[model samples]
Target: TLNSDTFTVTKVYSDASSDPQVGVSLACDEGGPPVTVTDSPQTTTGLTADFTVTGWTDATQVVCTATETSVPPGYNSSGTCAAALSPAGGCTITNTLNSGTFTVTKQYSDASTDPQVEVSLACVEGGSPVTVTDSPQTTTGLTANFTVTGWTDATQVTCTATETSVPPGYSSSGTCAAALSPTGACTIVNTLNTGTFTVTKVYSDASSDPQVEVSLDCDESGSPVTVTDSPQTTTGLTADFTVTGWTDATQVTCTATETS
Candidate 1:
């Protein structure tokens, strides 16, 4: 006479509520040959297979083991895969989810001269927001890193950056945004401001000199401008000067000299 026993193997997720249809295989060493069975779509309750034995009085020791063939994306198998068969039932295998990480690199348009600007970085992933300011208080090229381990493989994350305070002579422009990945990067830019000024020349004696040439010198790094007083009238003469890409903190001084 022969006896038959039913054995079962179950697959489960540790971090997820629903099954991800992981692939599993069960191998059992019978008396003569090894019987192998695979589950097409592994469920939480598992699949059951029947095994044949000699009889109830048979002394054959049967061993069954379960192995994972395929796992869900962004997840890893962290459970024990091997088990010994008994009259009770079979074994249960667990799959764990993996964590994801990303980085944000901070940049400035005037990093060469003004690198002490502070910026606020924020990141969100379907949950609470995480914020971090520039490290080292005052430094150039700062970075903020984030690590999230509770999300599934299909989750998406977004990060944004904004200037905490604008510098004296610069204007804040575009912001930074990115879809988070293992290795992602973004940039924020600021533009230097510009303005114009005028230089006026007046003559004490209109008839004394028919025409006079005057040289103007300023603190700004530029060639001196020579203005020719034409008609030598008492009315004031004016010259337009433009300063491009200057900051509010810059100090400007001007001086005039009579060349002729």
Candidate 2:
């Protein structure tokens, strides 16, 4: 009389809290029908299916393999799929979550030179936020890399950038809210501040003051102004100057010379 033996297949998940559970199909080399099962929610336990086959003389060897038919949104199968039937007569398959990487960049615009500004980048997954700093920035900009492991593939991640320290003559602008993409980047922008300068000339000897010429020169280019005061009187003379483009903290020198 040929006796029957039972073979079991189990599905195990590394992340028990994973939603939309994973499913797998199990098959054996022996003449038993294939069985399919879904993983249990508990990490310590697994879901199982049993197959009964006849013709076992105690020397029969059986091999089984498990294949993932469906995976959760953000997970991948990362364990051995094939195994020989153990003395206990069962096999297990494991599934692991997936991970991805991205970048955060800082950019400066409208500035005469690189401000070398410092900034902070914050990225958030479902859990806590991850923050990093980029200092001594350049005109070409700076970048920071981030890697998030053990996350589901469909999970949404967000990032934001802030200027920790702004240069004396610059202002920040533009939107920095970025969605995470593999090998992608989020950028922040800054512009230079602008203002006007006024120069006033007062003559100590009003009645006898000679016709004079006044000139103003700045260390930075495109910031020079010259004015002529003819037939000077008791009232002082004033000249308004505006820098053509952007200017940082600069040194200005003014001089007056008698023309008559």
The most accurate candidate by TM-score is 2
Q: Of the candidates shown, which would achieve the greatest lDDT relative to the real structure?
A: 1
**Span of 10 residues, lowest total lDDT, candidate 2:** 36-45
Off by more than 4 A, model 2: 1-61, 67-75, 86-97, 111-117, 124-141, 198-260
lDDT of 1 by residue, 1-260 (tens): 45555456566676654753646666666554664443422443333323332233332366666667666654677534554455544777677665554454545554644545465556666655543323213335455454544444323656665666666546776467775664344665666555555555556674443343445455444533222332222323654444444444245555655554
Q: How does each model score on TM-score? A: 0.45, 0.50
Candidate 2 has which clashing residue pairs, if any?
Answer: 74-152, 74-153
Give the alpha carbon lDDT tens digit for every residue of 1-260 in model 2. Answer: 65555556566666565343435555555436433222322232236555553444341455566566665554576543665454656666666655555565656665344635354556676655543333222334365555544445323666665666665445666446666664346666766554444555556775534323444344344454333232233223654444333334454344333333
* Local distance difference test values of all predictions, in order: 0.52, 0.50
Cα misplacement distance, residue 122 of candidate 1 (Å): 12
All models, RMSD in angstroms: 9.7, 8.8
Clashes per candidate, residues 3 or more apart or on different chains: 2, 2
